[model samples]
Target: MLTLTHRDMLTLKHRDMLAFGHRDMLAFGHMAMLTLTHRDMLTLTQRDMLAFGHMAMLTLRHLDMLTLTHRDMLAFGHMDMLTRTGTC
Candidate 1:
């Protein structure tokens, strides 16, 4: 297992913020590790951790929109993940 250096911790912190779209003036910190998945650290802010959880519930409500949803908008969110960005 790779022990987290200050730099690695900082990178992970940045990824967590970017993942949750929390682009505010607040300084976020890792309050907890959600889980240890394949050695990847999944940490979150106090507020964002709650928001991350609420996403599944929100997705359920929005799932119904799939039938009425426009194709362009749906593809926008996951266009990168759906396709390989020239990396392995």
Candidate 2:
């Protein structure tokens, strides 16, 4: 079982934030502020969730997944519909 204290959670968040590029610095500051304010009340699950979301976002950004245009959105929507209908 992995147990994390508030300080550990903050450290992890900061480290992950810094792993990205300069474009994410603003978001890093925002996350740091939010974590500092809510550190005392944060549960391990909540921290894990936040970290997971950040990791996903970072992965998407790194893969240029956030550069989707309107056409890409439409295509993705179509794909989602197909998957939902078990047709893809």
Question: What TM-score would candidate 1 get against the native?
Answer: 0.17
- Per-residue accuracy of model 1 over 1-88 as CA lDDT, tens digit each: 1222222222322222223223212231223122222224332222322211111111212112111111111111111222112211
Off by over 4 Å in 2: 1-32, 46-48, 52-88
Residue pairs in candidate 1 whose N, alpha carbon or C atoms collide under 3 angstroms: none
Residue-wise C-alpha lDDT for candidate 2, range 1-88, written one tens digit per residue: 2333232233323212222222121122111222322112222211111222121112222212222111111111211221111211
For candidate 2, report its TM-score. 0.16
What range of 10 consecutive residues in model 1 has the weakest lDDT sum? 51-60
Clashing pairs in 2: none
- Ten contiguous residues with the weakest lDDT in model 2: 70-79
